[model samples]
Target: MSQKKTVYIGPFIQCKTLTDLDICPNGMIGVDEGGRIAFVLRDERGRKIPEGDGWEDAKIVRIQDHGFFFPGFIDTHIHAPQYPNAGIFGKSTLLDWLNTYTFPLESSFADLATASRIYNRVVARTLSHGTTTACYYATVHVPATNLLADICQTRGQRAFVGRVCMHEMSPEYYRDESVETALRDSKACIEHVRKIDPEFDLVTPIITPRFALSCNTESLAALGKLHRELDLPAQTHISENPRECDLVRDLFPESKSYADVYESAGLLTPKMILAHAIHLTEEETALIRARDAKISHCPASNTALTSGRAKVRKMLNAGLNLGLGTDVSGGYTSSILAEAREAVFVSRHVAMDEGDEAKLSVEEALYLATRGGAKVVGLEDRIGGFEVGKMWDAQMIGLEAVGPETTELDQSAGPVEVFGKETWDDLVAKWVYTGDDRSTTAVWVGGRLVHAKEGFRL
Candidate 1:
């Protein structure tokens, strides 16, 4: 978190649009003391400073030939309390999975010591994987939920923290006691975040109803009213499982559909982020579009939890805003790079059943990972790309080049091998398919150095 001016020079790549990547082979970008990008110059030679305004001693970060700087990732849906259970779903689906593995694990967060240890580790891990922004769901406990916001603030990660509310049908030991208690606890968490980051420049509070099945009409309506009154963004699950949809129908017989449940409660709005819209109907999609709500396509979790594939191409064709979510624990990973690649495979599966037109290219998936994710979290104007005024929320990605003298392969750069034959697009595709956190040498959020691998220096 240096207050002095800094300049990053060398290859820079970012998604300028959904279908285009802005690849500047040699570029120079300046960041002022307050962390906003001051100027951008393309094809600059030899780390030359912009004609001076007293920046002779500015810090310089130069990237290697095989590396490029890309925008940091955004995870729109993930459970902060379930990070330990990643890759442990076994043979369970939604409801049974919640009862058997999810609830009991989440209930343990009532302990502050347990909450602090896990929150710190998960935040560090995600930042290591180049995730600068995330929308996190915390348990019903107020103290632990507030602790998560504090951790994100301290770690310099941009986050939307929400205290989950499920006043009915959830287990007695874990559910919120009543609607009043649910709203009261949620307000306390919001106030706690405001106290820490008063302007919400780094962290903000989000409304969480924990999906329709876990909440009754009274609690949902009350939470919805709170959302409107506070003018805060919200995140929740939707149509992730067939059994869950059936349960929603039985529980609220008056509602027309799963989307109707939220609409009736006033929870569906432009600020709402719906995760895993895998089984959404045409009408339901239309209603969501009409409301201008956002969608977080968690492909890794959908396939792991046995949820059906989401029709992402259709959503885009219908002019919907969509992004990627790790949905960790259910997703079995914290890396959004893995999530972006999984989205490619999920789109291929979708194309197999529907048509080839449903397929998503590597460029499209990366856009969902960066630009679309920024849109989902309501920070498109501030982050997600390189521009004159946007903050520097980005990661430096390095790929190992194979030379003739190589005897043993380097394990630090992961499995992606660049042999000097790849086009710019091919190189990007290789990383998307096989790259891991090893390729992320350094990460920054709002010009603050948050995480870096061993031996990496500016």
Candidate 2:
């Protein structure tokens, strides 16, 4: 039998937060396509197994002088077309931004070169932030959107790129093909980019109707039918800004709420992803969660744009499948760490004001950024957590340089060399509260090194 390479990450932290903080040791994790604790044990014993089926011939991989490795961060919502204008479009609230800056900027994507440049920057920035997978929204230009899929496929990043459809009610500069044309473009875009690499696993297409206001019922219905027919995921904004929600109510008065508008059009299914689900009523929340639709809690974006805070704790208690998203341009950062931190912050503020004070915690925020985001994008079992039999998409955060006094670890680490022997929870807490892209020294996807801080080559 041929030999398959064996890799051992030693003395590194694993988020043993899954099974038992008691059973998990701060030792090692072995990763191939899937992670196995047995592999880690063998490596600690100085055994170098073969790369393939011939385990006797395997060679051991030792990563020297680094910190812990955990599952790669996932961003449940981002806009590839808005990368360039990230901080520039922060002038106004949602609708105003959409009309003035966002619409004009997105209109530029019709130029393939422009799209290529922007998409390249978007991919690099997200990767640099240790986001191995992202659910991205592209402009209404189908060709430009497909260019995004191509870039993601080549980069070996797992992504869901949506070809946005806007057949009516958007600013002239941003609206796209008519209902029939939007449907056709979405279909063509999906079929064209379904397979790029041999594995045909990197890129997937999603149908993105801009929103209830931008899409006529006919267009949304057609997109919904296409969503069900192709078994593709559907994503879009909903109840983000109070004004936007008002406009949606005005447009779809026959519906009960923004969520109902989508439901009436047959788009409220389990695979649908709704971004910025703030301002949703209790009934609306119940309806969306009932259908198993997921919410991408973009706390930074909501707060930065002056949109009201989402009741994330309430949604969680309602049993909603929720995840964290950077929402990039609006969020002002690409790091999912920032997402987690802000999720905890905003949820606590909301909970303090509305719900009980015990609603939000740092651990819950971390869950949203990691496992929750993975599940929302339909990649939970494959990409999230350090569980066995899951794809090896993870990042190593080097917190050895951080002082325990700088963090909550002051209480946990006692008097010893605080950074020397840290637990998975210690590493995670540092990453969420104190770390950023700068803190991520190494990253891996599918068991292959993608980004390293001046170490191994990609």
Instruction: Name the candidate that leads on TM-score.
Output: 1
Runs of candidate 2 with Cα error greater than 4 angstroms are: 1-4, 11-23, 33-52, 56-63, 197-200, 355-359, 402-424, 456-458
lDDT tens digits, residue span 1-458, model 2 = 11244455454443334223222333445554333223544234553443455454444544444455666888999988888777665558987877776778888998999999989888977887889999999988878888899988777678998988886766766776588888888887887776454344678888899788888778888988998998889999999999888888787888888999899888999999999999989999889978999999999899888998988877877889888898878888888888888888887788677866536666777677778888899887677776656766777665544454565543422122235566656655666787767666667677655677654432
**Candidate 1: tens digits of C-alpha lDDT, residues 1-458:** 45778899888999978888888988988988878889999987765697686567889998965889999999999999999999999999978889898999999999999999999999999999999999999999999999999999999999999999986766889998888998999999999999999999999999999999889999889988999999999989999999999899999999999999999999999999999999999999999999999999999999998988999999999888999999988999999999999998999998988999999988999999999999998899999999989999999998889987887867665677888888888889998999999899899899999999899888
| TM-score of every prediction relative to native | 0.98, 0.88
lDDT of 2: 0.76
What is candidate 1's TM-score against the reference?
0.98
The whole-model lDDT of each prediction reads 0.92, 0.76
- Looking at model 2, the pairs that clash are 3-51, 3-52, 4-51, 4-52, 5-51, 48-58, 49-58, 50-57, 50-58, 72-394
Error of 1 at 229 (Å): 0.7
